[model samples]
Target: MRESRFIAVKLISVLKPVIDRRRRLALIVDDTLMARSCSKKTELLAKVYDHDKHEVLTGYRGLTVGWSDGNTFLPVNFALMSTKKKENMIGNQPVTADQRSIAGRRRTQAQRPMNAVTVELLKQTKKVYYRYRDRLYDVKGLYERLAAAKTRQ
Candidate 1:
């Protein structure tokens, strides 16, 4: 049999069991910092900016979206966000939730893709999701999107 690049995966038909035992499997999304970059010899740090003051106010911050498999947490999404620049602090300063996007209304939006390792990890991560078929093929096309992002990288 010839080997195909993409696996012909079938959606499994099983509801997630509510087992109280620790052996119950769950999804785990994790991100590890490879390194950091800085100007001069300044110390590199992972800091989430202050949402109000819009400043890099020390300490590590990143978003990792996960899915609970009725037992444990499974990381399904992770985004490494760059610190928002304090640009135009005087013009349209302090953007609130209802505030419009700085880029303004859009007609044709850009398709920014994802990284490669994320793609491979996502590919290897789908086995946990087969139990979700009755909940709708909720994770459909996730792998393709991840692969596209890898190619973009």
Candidate 2:
């Protein structure tokens, strides 16, 4: 995760010049499905609404954010959407004790209502961005301090 964050920071830095020149950049948010229909025993398998398909598909929904410049898209962050509640729409059937326990662990970070998942995804992305932003400022401050010390000598 940390590595991915650092890579995002690097990517943003590389794109900064073009972004500034165009003065237009988009932060895209999207959710996608990773179907697991063949595996009935797959952990956290649930009904996920596919907006484009206009139907509920049995799979995992992945909410992700990315930066785009009308052409190129750079994925910044992502979070898996899981419906682990006892009364979800599709996965209404009861599971055995062992399956329940496994599903519980799989749904540890479960968020509801789609909107909640989007909010969580944005929050996580914001966190990573701020962390890198702060680190950049710290480095700038250090550079300034070093330059001042050199001038004094």
Candidate 3:
């Protein structure tokens, strides 16, 4: 599907029975370094701290959120993060400020704090839950319908 929120909502619903049995539910948030050192043309590539290797690495950080009732864990949402603090340029070559394009603007916005990104993901999850909680159709049916609609175009 085009929207990840819908899939997240479905996954959450499937795990609802397991979650409801527990007295407390925990939302887990974490960021992982996806190594892409061989890539030179990737946008938003930056130096990310790798906890496992105890060193800095070049790659993108994927921030994710999941729900756990101490047993069953379900990933709900995620966002790619970057540390590209400045506009893209041709290696050390001088460029005017007017040369910054839409990609540069997006890179700056993608540098948001981890907490802010987590909060945004949680808000989206809550919204998806409330909007579809009362629905009766299964996820398979919903996806099939969506597929059919796409083919009609």
Candidate achieving the largest lDDT: 2
| Candidate 2 residue spans exceeding 4 A from truth | 87-106, 130-153
lDDT by residue for model 3 (1-153), tens: 116767766776777765555346666666678987777666567767787788877777776666656676666667777764554321221222232775444344457655455556656667665422221212223335534655776
| Candidate 1 lDDT score relative to the true structure | 0.34
Candidate 1 colliding pairs: 27-73, 27-74, 28-74, 29-75, 114-149
Candidates arranged by lDDT, highest first: 2, 3, 1
Local distance difference test scores for all models:
0.34, 0.59, 0.58
Task: Evaluate candidate 3 by giving its C-alpha RMSD to the native, one decimal.
Answer: 13.6
Predicted structure with the largest TM-score when compared to the true one: 2
Question: What TM-score does model 2 achieve against the real structure?
Answer: 0.63
After TM-score superposition, the amount by which residue 132's alpha carbon in candidate 2 deviates from its true location, in angstroms, is 14
Writing each residue's lDDT as its tens digit, candidate 1 over 1-153 gives 011112222111122344444443444344333223332222223343455455654432233434454544434544442323334111222224332563321100111122333443344445434333211122324446655665777
15-75, model 2: which lDDT tens digit per residue? Answer: 7766646445656676668876665655557777666678877877776677666667777
What lDDT is reached at residue 110 by model 1?
A: 10
- Decide which is better by lDDT, 1 or 2: 2
